[model samples]
Target: MSISRRTVLGGLAAAPALAALAACGGSGGGGTTEITYGYIPDFNGASLLAIADDRGLWEENGLKATLQTFTNGPLQIQALGTGDLDFGYIGPGAMWLPASGKAKVLTVNGVGQADRVIAQPGIDSLEALAGKKVAIPEGTSGDMIVQLALQSAGMSLEDVEKVAMDPSTVVSAFSSGQVDAAGIWYPMIDNIKQQVPDLVELAQNSDFADVMQFPNVMVTSATYPEENEATTLAVLKVLRAAMDVRAEDLDTTVELTAKLTQQDAEAVAADASNGQYYTAAELDALVGDGTVETWLTAMNEYFEENGKIEGETVAPADYFTFDLFTEAGK
Candidate 1:
């Protein structure tokens, strides 16, 4: 669960190797439908992978799913852009960056809540971060969450000394009193709070309703979905089954997630039942109402206003295609 800073930084350099692994064929038997799946080793994706592997859902669906691990979303997107991955779980923000023509990928199904943000002890207000160093991985969901949280307090990134650090480093920074706060996700967030008993969650996705629903989405290369719609549908079917499994059996789901995240089973169960997982119906509504698009546009506008876009405009819809999910629904 504790990833080293060196590993996080190494991802940028290991993009080629990760992409190569993603491009490799599945390990299933002869004539089986092979589909590569890329995921970060987090609680959310880990749960799904555990269930799919344990329950043999992929095999049951005739899908030889090859689960590939990536260090972060950017690298995952990079591999996805190169046709290295057929499908993967990634943050919507990561999809937004590449959807601007930097990468060739499309969103399939929205998976879980964006329950990640800045946690600081005794920082009852965002103003507390003013002049204090706050840690975040640049150009990531955590970064965006921190930005939006600051905006909610009528403040901006300029209010704090932004420390561009990965999730792993954030913990060490906070532990050493080198940073005032860290924008991070579960397992890390839970782990940090436990270590620093005084640490408090300052901001989270729930703080911003519009952005809160920005779930982790299942994505694939544009070409794969275009040329292999059936296969894409089949994959969705497997995911849908996994979702159902999660809903029907909470204890089992939590145990599997714990095994994958290497966290306590009780803690994992608490997080699982914590309203992070989304139902298929809820995901459908998000897609139908252009909720994802609107959220992306808002994020794009934020990036642009903050001068992160750098003389370029990104179209949100370009990063997503509800066709596969729609087909699966039918």
Candidate 2:
């Protein structure tokens, strides 16, 4: 089944009006498309996009991209739906948007296994966190780590005393012994670890990799892929080039990521080595061999089972514009 804005927004009946507005925005001189790209300026989430912008990769690839920083993925999705953003570098927690036909995941940038569930040494396993105060950024990938780990331990968020706090605050609270455990991501995890010397890592995304894939992904509005195929492919090429830049120079990439995200170079350095960054060929192989489909299918199923996605299940093909990546590889 094809998933497009048309399908969710009443098919062709509503396309013309939205298309008319979308067309008026992305035009640029010299045969370039001026697009507004959204990204979360948190270290890992913003790394590649930051690298691309820092190195002028967007302009180099023939696009005039106006980089926009979003506080979170939901806001980016909201912008995409409203035609404010042409593309977004977002986290996996917002994958539900594509599954619900609100957006389309263009490419899985990399495995952001940076999120972790940590406890104050005594609380050893995920199950041990039951009835303990656990700070979590509600509705984030970090929260996903907590819930998925708890599910494996036969517990749920209800079993824990949930403390809803921002990531930085979670680090402070967990460090000060106010929360027994906290759902957080690096470099905040790194920050809390320094203070709480014997912090026990209860779980991380890699531990649940067999059941779900939590990766940083590139997404656009449901109609963007259908209407701007060439521009989308150009963006992918720019991302691939950015990955090459990142691989060729670790020191520079770290510095750029730290600078762009305004994070500490040390913390960024510590967290940088935590996840896998796939090259274009690697991404092409993942999609070609069905690994991409399998991972996303698992992710969608997990979201559906948790009531995070409503209505009928969205097949991987419905939400993924993987063909664009394949074309970009060529």
Best by lDDT: 2
Model 1 misplaced regions, further than 4 Å? 2-31, 102-122, 259-264, 270-275, 306-314
TM-score of 1: 0.80
Can you write out model 2's per-residue Cα lDDT over 42-86, one digit (the tens) per residue?
A: 555567777777777766667777666666676777889999778
Best by TM-score: 2
Q: What's the CA RMSD for each of the models?
A: 4.8, 7.7
Candidate 2 local Cα displacement, residue 294, angstroms: 1.3
Candidate 2: lDDT over CA atoms?
Answer: 0.74
Per-model TM-score on C-alpha atoms: 0.80, 0.85
- Per-residue lDDT value at 91 in model 2: 71
lDDT tens per residue, model 1, 206-285:
67875544555666765676787767777776777777777678689878867765577876665554345655666677
Candidate 2 global TM-score:
0.85
lDDT of 1: 0.64
